[model samples]
Target chain A: MKIVVCAKYVPDATGDRKFNADNTVDRVGVDGVLSELDEYAVEEALQIRDATDGEVVVVTVGPEVARAAVLKSLQMGADSGVHVLDEAIHGSDSAATSLILARAVERQRPDLVLCGMASTDGGMSVVPAMLAERLGLPQVTFASEVVVEDTTVRIRRDGDAATEVIEATTPLILSVTDQCNEPRYPSFKGIMAAKKKPVETLTLGDLGIAADQVGLDAAWTRVDGFTERLPKSAGTVVTDDNGSGADQLVSFLVSQKFV
Target chain B: MSEILVLVDHADGSVRKTTAELLTFARRLGTPSAVFIGAGIESARDALRQYGAERVYVVDSPDVGDYLVAPKAEALAQLVQRTGPAAVLLPSNAEGKEIAGRLAIKTASGLITDAVDVTPADGGVAATQSVFAGSYTVNSAVTHGTPIVTIKPNSTTPEAVEGSAVEERVDVTISELAKTARVVERKPREATGRPELTEAAIVVSGGRGTGGNFEPVEQFADTLGAAVGASRAAVDSGWYPHAYQIGQTGKTVSPQLYVATGISGAIQHRAGMQTSKTIVAINKDEEAPIFELVDFGVVGDLHTVLPAATAQVQARKG
Candidate 1:
């Protein structure tokens, strides 16, 4: 059995996430790293493969720097990596991303496909569902816990109103949340092993995709404009020096009609 | 009139407040047409009518009610083809986002999720998104087919307005592929008699300062009839269940009032509630980083501040 892990390199959430001249995220100026959330998906994939004695292949599609995403997964115990880098892939929306990812995942036929619940940058949390629709497979997303037995896969989804247990078979897409498992750090030996592992690079042409079908020019959504939110005013601050802190807060709430 | 399709979000034949919020917001673009895809239209009709629903399309299909979101997406795809609405509006929950995602592909439309506001633009509906932990405000629009947008709850006040709410029953042929994944079991959270966090007007949250005790936080929330929430730190430390965790991965709440007790206000936690109309914090540390952004602050221990404040509020009410 083979499992494919879909990973992404996102702008660091701690940095000042800014927009470029073209309204795209400023990935160049800000430090980029493998999305912290995707680490759980990579870990879950590795565990499933270790249990089943299969190969774990990591796939990513983005700018050239996105190869780091694949490399990070490789260092964490993946067998190989595939980076889909192309100049035409910039500013792709979730729809375009699902298209590219669906093609890249199709290039590597696997029993299971896994992805993080959402990227910290885009944070749309819609790509996995769209990819499932594009790939014509069942998708069990937002899995807090996953257990696999033979060909059956079950996941516990913690939603807003309820916690549901969903079941599906192989040949499907699964997205794991941060609660799934703890992501392991790459040991020195694992890093050395990852250096020798095969890392293949592909372009839009290699995946049978047209340049006109991607990038900002072909995106379905357009950014009209943006503005920096004005800094909020610091209305009041009261210390507990006189034991009147709670009373002050209640008075403020009363003035605001919250009491 | 250009029609805007609003998908009803319901549970066990009861409509959720998010649906009312969605319908109220959808009216800004065009005439609001609700798409009810389960067995609860009868119970939801009055609320829908009260919220200015000009037309209500119903599909009480078992295949859709029993399965995950894919079947509903398929059913919506057929509806979009038949009605050709100006835009599709759905609640920005997990299920609603997934449905809009698949429906975007099936209808060849642009998908925007977690939009805080939507309005009519020149070519299409413009969505206002709060990005980068509420640092930037972005205005976006769909450039492709029908615009599909998922709106976050508490985006706007749900105002009651009379409407025809003329009902229409439609049949959608759901494909077998959509029903592949099955919901084997459901364990709904036990009733707390509190408002849902995301849709609440007021929310009081606690963090590491609680030291595994949420009684004070719950008591304060109960006094004000507000919802209860916990920071990711509290949940990860086993102080609270994951269901009530509020952070970047957990629920993002934009309520009218947000009070953080004992939380140091990490960037992740700030992202979840930064857009709140009024922010207040109570912490022992004066420089807890949460103070810089809050509208009001009290420098003291949460255990002492919250209970005292709760009592004062109760006294004021009496």
Candidate 2:
């Protein structure tokens, strides 16, 4: 069996992340690494591959810098990496991104495709299902636990009200939640092995995707305007003395009608 | 008037608060129509009516309820084709977003998730999204097909308006691909008896300062009938479950009131709850960053502070 894990290189959440003038996130120079959430997907893929004696391939669609994301996954035990890098792919929305990824995954002909619940940067959580739709495959998303047996892939999805055990056949898309498993860090040996791993790069032309079909111009959604969040102002503070802190809090709650 | 389709999120037969919230918001764009894909439409119809649902489209099929989200997405996509609504609104939960994404692709529509607000604009709808962990707010509009939106809970108040929600049984064909993912079993969560964290009007959360003791936090939350949350630090340390985590990677909540105890207020934690209407924090460290966003701050140990606050609230209720 073959497993393909979709990964993204997102700006470090701790960094002062900024957007370019065109409203796209500036991903050029700022510190970036594989999206923390996608690590779970990579980990799940590796686990499934290990159990089934399968090959694990990591796929990403971004600028040249996004190779870091694929490299990180490769270091974490993937067999190889594919990076779809093209200038025309910049500012692609979820739909276009899924289209590109679907084409890339089709090239791999994987038995299973894995993705994170959502990218740390986009936080939209839409691409996995969209990718499944574009591929005409079943999707079991937000899986807290995934297990494979023969031709079936089963997952435990924990919702606010209940937990559901859902399963699908092979050649399906699955997006794992952060609670799925603890992602493994790259060992020194794994890092050294990743240096020799093959990394393939593809462009829109290579994927048979038209230049006009992607990029900001063809995106279904566009950022009309944006505003930087204002710095929060200081609030009233009360130091506990004579046990009056609770009284003050209760009074404030009453005033706010929270009581 | 063009109708706005709102997916009703519920459990068994009971409707969730987020459905009412979506209905309330849908009324702003067009006439509100509810799409109930699972069983128990009879029980959910009253709440849907109260929330101004002009019509309730019911698809009470085991093919939808006994499976994952794909069938529901297919059903909604079919409904969209049949009705040609202005927009479709769903709760921005895990399942809702998955269904919305598939529906978007199936209908060749533009999908927006985790929208803080949606209003009529340019004959479509404009959605305001809080992105980059709430460091920026972006206004967006769909340029392609119909706009499919998934809104966060507590983005607006659920206003009850009297409307006769006439039920319409809609027949939908569940695609073979959708039926491949079948739900084998469902295990009901052990009821905390407390309200759900996202839908609760008041939320009392504990952080690393609790030192693995959620007793005081639970006591305070119970006293006020609020839900309980935990900081990522606390959750990472195995002090609480990840489901209870409130942070950038965890569930984002915008309750009417949010109280943080013993939390240092890291940006990740703030990213989840900063949109809360009113915030109050208590910590021994007076300089904790959590105080910056709080409307009221108390400098004291959570062990000493939360108990006292709980007593005060209980006594007031008595």
Candidate 3:
């Protein structure tokens, strides 16, 4: 069995994030690391590989900085990595991104594909389903727990009002929620070993995708403008000197029509 | 005016609040129509009619309930082909987003998720999204096909405007690929008797300041009939379950009233609740960041302040 995990390199949430003139996020000079959510996908892939004695391949689509995302996955027990890098891929929307990812996954021809529920930067949880649609594979998404048994994968999805048991056969796509499992840190030995692993690089031409089909110009949706949030101004503050804080709060709630 | 298809989110026959909100918003751009996917259209019809649904497209097929989001997407896509609606509205939950994404691909449409607001623009729809953990607001419009939008819960208030909810059955064929993911069983969650966190009007949340005890938070939430939420600090400390977390990684809630108890608001935590209409913070430390966005701030111990507030609310109601 071969399990492919899709990962992304996103700007650190704590770093100063800015947008460029093109209304795209400026990820060039900022601190970039593997998206915190994708770690769960990698961990799930490693667990499945350990159980089935399969090979785990980490795939990513981004600039040169995104190679680190695949490298991190390799250090965490993945066998190999595939990085799809190109200049024209910048500012591609989720649909275009899924197109490139589906092409990459076709080259691997894996039995199972996994992804995080959403990316930290875009926060759009639509790529996995779009990829599944493009690849013509069944998707079991937002899985909190996953169990594989004899060419079948079952997952527990916790919804707002109920918990559902969803199952799909092998050669399917699944996106795991953050509740799946705790990700492991890379060890010194594992980091050293990852340096010797093979990391394959591909371009849009290699994947048979035209440059006109992606990039900001080809995006179906474009950001017309963006505004930074204003600093929150302080509201009314009261000290409970005479044990009247609760009363004051009630009065304020009444004034604001919150009660 | 062209029709705006609102995907109804419901359980059995009861309509969810998001559907009503979607229908209310849909009336702003075009004529509002609802697409009810499973059985129980009769149970949901009154709410649909009350919220200005001109028609309800019913598809009572076992394939929709038995499979995952694929069949539902297919059904919606088929309706889009038949009705030629200007836009499709769905709630921005996990299932809704997936169905929207698949429907976009199937219909060659532009998809937008987590939109806080949608309005008519240049013969199409323009959407506003809170991105980068609510630090940036982006306005976007689709340049391609019809817009398939997934709106966030609590983005709009539901307003009743009576209309006819005449049911029309939609015909669709579920593809072989969509039938691969089958739902085996469904177990209802243990009822907390409180409103859902995302849809609740009031949310009372605790953080690390609770020191691993949520009893006060639960008590306060129960007294006010509000949903109980926790900051990431509390959830990471094992004081609360992850499902109850409200932060960048957890659920985003835009409730009418949000009460913060013992939480020193981090940006991630604030990202989830800053959009709430009214906020109140109670913490012992006067310098907590949670006080910055609150409409009212109480500098007192949460253990003391929350119980007092709960008692006051309960007494006033009685």
Candidate 4:
């Protein structure tokens, strides 16, 4: 079994975010790490690789700096990495991004493709579904647990109020939810071995995909202007006057029509 | 004189509010035509007509509805090829985003997801995206095939324009290749009697300070007909479902009013709900980060604050 795991390098969600003069994100100073959710995708791919005896290939599309993300995944026990780097690939929306990824997956021809439910930076959980559509494959988005047995994969999807079991055949795509599994940490040995692992670099042309087909120029949408969030006026902070705290709270609640 | 294809996001042919909103946005760029991908087209026709869809392209194929997004994309791709619409408008939900992505590639068109607004520009739809956590607004136009845009819910108020929408049955054959994966079974969510989160006018979310006690938070949410959300900490602590997490790592939601209880607003959490029109926070700590972005703040124990508020709302209704 062959598995392709799509990963992204995004700003550490916990890092301080700064905006550039143009109002785009100042990603340079921020720590660019593997997306937290993508880790689970990588981990889930490894789990499947372990269970099925196959190679786990990590793929990402970004600038030259994106090599670090692929390397990190390699460090975390992936067998290999593929980086699709092109300046023209900059600012591709979910649709364009999925196109690039689908081309990469087409090049690899994997039996299964896995992705995190959404990227931490964009939080647009649209890629997998789009990829599934582009690849013309079955996709189970937001899968909590996926167990591959024989030729079919049994998945548990966490719905609003219930858990659902869905079954899909092989050569499928899954956008794994965080509930899938606790991702494994990169062990010291794995990290060191990753340095020696081969990470293949491919340009958009190398994948037989035209860069002109994606990127900011071909992107369907754009951002016009952005404003910082409006500062909220502080709400009333009615402190307790000894035992009268509850009464004051009730009065305040009544005033707000809450309760 | 190209038409705009609006994908009707509905359940059992009951059009969703976002559908109306999409039609409202679609009409801005081109003539509005609805693409209903479901089993019940006859039941959906009246509402589709009411929302200014000049034509209803009905694909009442169970094969399209039985599976997930792939087949729907195939069906929409066919519609796009047939109508040569000026643009395609889909609700910016998870499924809609996927459909937009697939349809974009199939038609070799430019696709944009999470557009806050859409307008007519340069003989095409100009879409704006709130990017970089709403720090930058990007105005973009698809230069490739027909522009495919998915607008987020609540991005605009839907104004209905009653039209003589003629229903047309679009003959679509789902490609066997499209059904590469099938939904062997579907488990609809146990009805959470509350309103949908994105469409809800009010939302109440709990943060780490809740310490696993969501009783007051749920009660307050129930009182105001708001959807309940949790911060990553609360969800990580097993206090709530991960789906209810509102953060950079969770579902992004923008409502008219957002109430945070027992939450110290982390930037990641704020990324999810910062676009809300009004924000109120109740925290015991006066300096909790959640208060920084709130329109209203109450420095009190949420346990004390929320129940009182809930009771008041209940009494007001009584």
Candidate 5:
């Protein structure tokens, strides 16, 4: 089996993930980490590769920091990596990002493609679906458990209203949830092996995508304006030493018309 | 007025409240049309009329609902072509967003998800989105093609407005690729009799402080007619089901009122619910970060404070 896992480099969710002056995520100023969610996708792909004795390649579409994401996946057991970096790719929305990934994935010609359910920063969770649409591939997303038997893939999707067991043939797109598997830490030997893994870094010119086709100017959606939310004012806090705390809470709820 | 098409969210033909919310929001932009897929049109017609769906476009084809979201996207794309609608609205659920994403790409339209508000602006519809876990509010509009927006629940108070309720049957040709992922089995979640977590106006959440007991939280939630949620700590510790977990990787809910019990208000937990209009926390630690964001906080054990509050509410209602 030939598998390709999509990886993303996102701002550390724990820190102050601020936006640039242009309203895009400040990928340069902040500490970047391989998105916590993508680790699950990489681990799933690696497991599948191990079971089938096939190759796993990690793909990323971002700026320079995205290269690190690919490296992290390689360290986790991806056989090789592909990084699509271009200056014009900055400020691209999920739609454009999907287009770039589709182009990159088409180049690899893999039998299976995997992605995280959603990125930590944007949290749109739409890219995998968009990419599947562009590629005309069947997509089984939000998989809590994925089983591969021969060329058939079955996934358990834990939705809000129901739990669905979805089945699809290989050459389809699959996105996994955090509960799918516990990702492994990179051993010292694996880290050294990743350094020797082949990584092909390409630009838009190499992929036949024009600069005008992407970037902020070609975006279908525009952020007209934005505002930072004001810090919540300090709230009232009362001790329960007298056991009147519940009454005070009731009174507050009444005032807010919530009771 | 041009049509603002809304994909009706439903189960077994019973329309969900989010569909009414979408219709009410659509009225602000243009004519509201309900795109109903699969069975149960008779059961849903009144609700559609009550919420002001001027035209109810029915796609009764089993092909759309039998498969995953791709076929639904195909069906909507055909409707967009036929109606030349000004915009489209869908519930911001997993399936809805996927359909919207595919539709946007198919029709070359702009897509926005998790919009808190949508109103007419600059000759088109502009959506207000609470981003970065509600720390920032941004207003955006589709600059290219028709605006396809997925809205969150409880963003606006749905009002009843009777409409023409004309019905139109739509026929769509589903592609072979859209039929590849087949749902082999489906098990509906057991009913809790509480409101859906994301759609609930009020949510009561428990955390590590519950000590593996959710009785107080459930009792309080039932008393208030609110939904029950849980922090990751509670879910990870096997105190609560993972479906009820509310955090960065879990569900994001913006309710009118949110009550956190025994939660320390970690950033992950806050990201799931910080947009709530009013917040209240019950924790033993007065210094818990949850207190900083709450409108009112009680420094006490939830075991004691919640049961007392539940009884007090029942007495007041009586």
Candidate 6:
């Protein structure tokens, strides 16, 4: 079995996101981390590889900076890595990103493709479905559990209100939700072995894709500008002078139409 | 001129409120048509008619509803090919978003999701998105294939218009690759008396300041017929279900009216609801960041304030 997990490197979600004078994110001094959600997808792929004794490959489409994302996946136990880097791939929206990923997946022809339900930075859970459309493949989003038996894979999904069991064949796309599983930390042995893994770096020209197919030019959406929120004026402070919490609260409530 | 298509979101053919909302937005760009994929058109027709759908394309195919979003998207893509629609509109829920994303790539069209507003541009549709946790409002236009837009609910009040509801049988042949995955079984959610969070017009949310007691917040939500939401802190504490969390890590809700009680308005929390039309916050701490974005604010203990407000709203309803 050949399993592929898509990875993206982004600013650490926990870090403070600062803005530059031009309104773009200030990445000069911020620490970068593996896209938190993608880690779960990589873990799921690694577990599947472990079960099936197959090769696990990680792919990412971004700048040289994105190399870290693919390397991180390798450190987590992936057997191979592919980085599709080019200036043309920059500024692509979710749609364009899916197009590029679909093309790359088509070339690799993996039996299974796994992705995080949504990227933490974009928060737009559109890639899996978009890739499914581009590849003409069936996909299930927000998968909580996956079980492969014979030719078919069974999945249990924890939806908003209920749990459902789903069955799909290999070569299917599964976008794992955050609740799927707790990702494992990279062990010392695994980290050591990752350095020996094959990491192939490819450019857009090598893929035979047009420059106009992605980036801001092909993007369906454009962000005009970002305006910082206005600071809040001081709120009215109702002093609890009497020290009776209930009475003071009632007085304030009545004043605000809570009564 | 090809008609614009809308995927009618319904249960038992009864068109959902968001379907009307999408149709209202659809009319701004082109001729509006409704694509009803599953069964129950008989029950859904009245609502679809009232929502200005000139044509209701019905796909009575069995496999269409048996699986997940794949078949529905294939059907929509098929319809798009034949009818040559200029654009497609879908509600921005999980299912709709997935289907829309697939359909856009299948048609090689420009797709935009989570749009808060839409209006006609020179020759196409202009859509707006509140991104980066509502810190930025983006105005965009699709420059590629038929523009596909998935709009958030409650972005605009749905307006009904009289239209001849014409039904057409849409032919959809499933692709071999489309069957890569199939849903083996489905179990409906146990009915909760409360409304769905995404569909609710009003949402009342609690946060860390709730002190692990959600009674007051829940009571206020129930009184106002609003969905109950929680902050990650509240959900992490098991004060509420993870599904009710509204934050970067949780659900994104843009209700007409959002009431935040005892929430400090963390950036993560604000990312989920800052676009809401009207915000109201109640917290004893004047320093709570939630007050920064709210149109109305009250500084007080929710334990004493909520019961009285619930009574007042209940009395008004009476």
Q: What would the per-residue lDDT of candidate 2 be over residues A93-167, giving only the tens digit for each residue?
A: 999999999999999999999999888888889899889889988888889899899889999888877888988
Model 6, stretches more than 4 Å misplaced?
A: A12-31, A158-163, A185-197, A220-259, B208-213, B236-239, B282-288, B295-318
Pairs of residues clashing in candidate 6 = B13-B44
**Candidate 6 residues A125-209, lDDT tens each?**
8899888777777687788788876557788776654567878887878888666677888899988988899988887777778
What is the alpha-carbon lDDT of model 6 when measured against the actual structure?
Answer: 0.79
> For residues A140-195, what per-residue lDDT tens digits would candidate 5 score against the true structure?
99999999999999999988788999999989899999889989999998999999
- Candidates 1 and 5 compared by TM-score, better number: 1
Top of the candidates by DockQ: 1
Clashes of each: 0, 0, 0, 21, 0, 1
Where is model 1 more than 4 Å wrong at Cα? none
Output the worst ten-in-a-row residue range by lDDT, candidate 4 chain B. B131-140
- Tell me the lDDT of model 2 at B287: 87
Candidate 6 displacement at residue B16 in angstroms: 1.6
Better of 2 and 4 by TM-score: 2
Each model's interface RMSD (Å)? 0.9, 1.4, 1.6, 3.4, 1.1, 3.8
Pairs clashing in candidate 2? none
In order, candidate lDDTs are 0.91, 0.91, 0.90, 0.79, 0.92, 0.79
What's the interface RMS deviation of candidate 2?
Answer: 1.4
Stretches off by above 4 angstroms in model 2 are: A241-244
Candidate number with the higher DockQ (4 or 5): 5
The DockQ figures for the candidates are 0.84, 0.76, 0.73, 0.50, 0.80, 0.43
Error of 5 at B306 (Å): 1.4
TM-score of chain A of each: 0.97, 0.97, 0.96, 0.92, 0.95, 0.88
What's the TM-score of each model vs. the native? 0.98, 0.97, 0.96, 0.91, 0.98, 0.88
Top-TM-score candidate index: 1
Q: Lowest summed-lDDT stretch of 10 residues in model 5 chain B?
A: B60-69
lDDT of 3 by residue, B186-254 (tens): 987787888989999999999988999889899989887799999989988889877788987789999
Error of 1 at A229 (Å): 1.6
